[model samples]
Target: MNASPSHQPHPAEWTETQSLLPCVERDLPAGRHQFHKEQLMARIHEDLRTTTRPEPPKRRPNPFLRRTVLLPAAALALAGAVAGGFALSSGDPHGGRTALATGPALTTTVGAADAEGAPRLLDRISLAAADTSTPTPRKGQYIYIESKVASTYTSSVGDKTSVVSEELHPRQVWNSLDGKDGWLIEPGQTGDEGITLASEVVMSGAYDVLATLPTDPDALLRRIYRESDATRDHEVPRDQAAFTAIGDLLTESYPPADVSAALYKAAAKIPGVVAVDDAVDATGRHGVAIAREDGTGERTEWIFDKKTLRFLGERVVVVKAVAGSPFKVGTVVFTSAITQRAVVDANKQVPGGAS
Candidate 1:
């Protein structure tokens, strides 16, 4: 069993946020910009984006990396933060790394979600995934995934707190199948030249790691629960963790076809999983969403094309607002669209052999 991550601050993160405790009146992990910006754009940020979901109902926010629905997902996303260049300061006296580009807080029509619609939608999605072909990376090949990502978080400066969003930006990552080697490039987060991914294996989101998981939905689901145990926030339900871990795999990972199918099937088994009739990605592509509401007032949605059942992107929305929350209902806290995923012959090589 993967035990839940202890609610202790990671040394580096503590160094990053410890001082802000006296100043930040809002709750969040991974320091966000303290800007006067009037709006927000939510992004999954994955291991690439450093945003996080809100904390559970009444608990004091844990600034620890465990702020997101899945700790592993944050860990996977941290791969980018670890292999980095400096963050662009958004006029922070606190030295928080945030982009200067800010946008209006993203909003959406609150799509109706059928409480029981998950299983059926997932089944269709599973069939679609199983029918698709996934390429296996060669020894020197890299898995390139390019996405448009944006994020939202509360920024408190001087007594005024407002929601801020990073402008939608491209995030590109090239990972070796084994997870050992990779590259990351995001303008504000990693800089223009990008950085080498020389960090530890992104255990849950790695293609090689996912390739080894069981394909049987039942078995796969059980494994998911076990692996997700580590990131469990006791205030939050364990099923949310499982759902989130699966969400990480489904979004950031390029799993094998069989594993992909099994993941959708496994997601169907998680309680509270629902199907949203309408949702949009960071790029404005509309799709159906398979979502799980973490009691923490946010619904993490995985959007897929309605016709092809192909995944388009992920969005986290504010469904039920909490007291003192800067977000309103229908507020989209995060969104990411995977524009491309392909097997590249070499590191940092994009599709069509473009570098």
Candidate 2:
């Protein structure tokens, strides 16, 4: 239930300062710093563009740096996939289904697995989760995560109409084990510099917070219910809030075996969770899913390996029609495949990549 920091506008003159300043100001050795402010700013701009903009305006390339300068550390945490669709399209009233290139959204007409489906599948998943071992990251280590992510937003080009755009890319994050620091490392680029994990970082992505979560199903569920209530202010349905909380936890955090098992079991207690026997991730891996439909005309599905019971990824599909949304029933608005995760020694280090 951690809230991301809201976006705040920065000084308009920051862009002018950036464009006017030299990458290397003083007489400095070439490799002493091994990083440039402009490069880091550019990388931050790109990240902001993908996460926050549908189609960023073309005024200045560095304008996004200003917007992103405002996103908090937990803002790097991916949005909860369970609340609604991934929003592959901007708010384009006339936009077509081009964003559905990965696949069309699955219509709600497709029946979810029966009421008994969740308990049975959850029992198996919980068992597997309990049996599996995920190392508890130590301080000074990095929790490295690699995933294929896609996001969408809408932009109004004029007073008359708007255009929707979607961006899909591979993202990697190296979070400090202590929840004190982190880095967002785009491929082939030095990790963006100076990321500080906020004290209120989301439970799912914060190692220290994950260690503190309750491992008992009933207790865990109650805790999530209460916390989500406080954060969402009862505006979101209890079940939806709980489900979204679980979704964020499942996708981003690797809790201890008992806590992980408890999360799945707790999800089963939520009223609307249903089973989907057939689901596919962005990586084209097929698996089963436990899903819930929100009032917002979308179904969030957490896919898991059918045989091993390992979580594969999550996806969002449109189930109802909405005005000003370029999505239709059965259109897969967003999909992400978690390709890998590991603990590393430094923020700049990834498995089999440069240190």
Candidate 3:
């Protein structure tokens, strides 16, 4: 792992007098320069809030439940469906059966087909539709959700064996676009309890909220791109200096190779996954490549379970920079492991009006 940069004191560091005083007052051109610098800093700070991504709502783990175990029958059914060409759900927890049905009509401009010959386009459409139909449990709504998570991490510097179990609670709801009518609820709590050699620790923290798209793969990609852009534009700048500092630190710590390897390892485990591809976006930024991993490894493609129209859980990777390093060190193998609770209202209007 890459270490943080040393905090060596520089002999030429600016003193308070030199940095704070107006240079023009002393009959020098530096005073005018100082004024301009101040103005620039002020503008940056002012624009930061508007430009930053919206902070995801607060989610707390549910405390009432301890461990949520998937019934053997359900597990086997899900595994079989994923291995085959279809997708499956455990259905509603309230004893109601909501079968996995065909997703809404949508189209995609990107992605390739997977190994089993399932059209990635259809998968995206399915996801978009599910996203639209799924309702997140809100403050007053009756929603049902079930999750299973497995997480492993090294202990903080002084501690040995890190483990925890937590129950997540729902906090807020956001509407999904892509033509499916439903809302996405950001769960506040984590469901998995961390286990270590000595003791089990309940890990409780906010998880990232993602917009589910209807089954159309292209539609799903569009929503993902849009949400990511919104996050970068609105949420990142709220704490501009802090985010910038973290970016700088990451650049100085790890090598590019290490970061790439970590990402590949995480991507390999997603179900129905075939390969990982890479590309440059329209703006020339380096973009991610997630393709179907065929036997030859030459064919580029995207992974999706055609039956349920849901992206395989393993394919969704969360990349976070390792603190003080230029490398990405940590990896979480599962995506659906994060708690997702949905509320179905036969009477309420769609959560948010379509854009």
Every model's TM-score: 0.74, 0.67, 0.25
Q: Which residue ranges in model 2 land beyond 4 Å of their true spot?
A: 1-111, 152-167, 186-204
lDDT of each: 0.57, 0.50, 0.21
Once fitted onto the true fold, the runs of candidate 1 whose alpha carbons sit more than 4 angstroms away are 1-98
Candidate 3, position 336, lDDT: 21
lDDT of 1 by residue, 134-222 (tens): 66777777777666666666656677666766577666666677666666665455445665554333434566776788899999888
The lDDT, on a scale of 0 to 1, for candidate 3 is 0.21
Q: Which of the predicted structures, 2 or 3, would earn the higher lDDT when compared with the native?
A: 2
- Measured on C-alpha atoms, candidate 2 has an lDDT of 0.50
What is residue 161's positional error in candidate 1, in angstroms?
1.4
Worst 10 residues of 3 by lDDT: 1-10
Which prediction has more favorable TM-score, 1 or 2?
A: 1
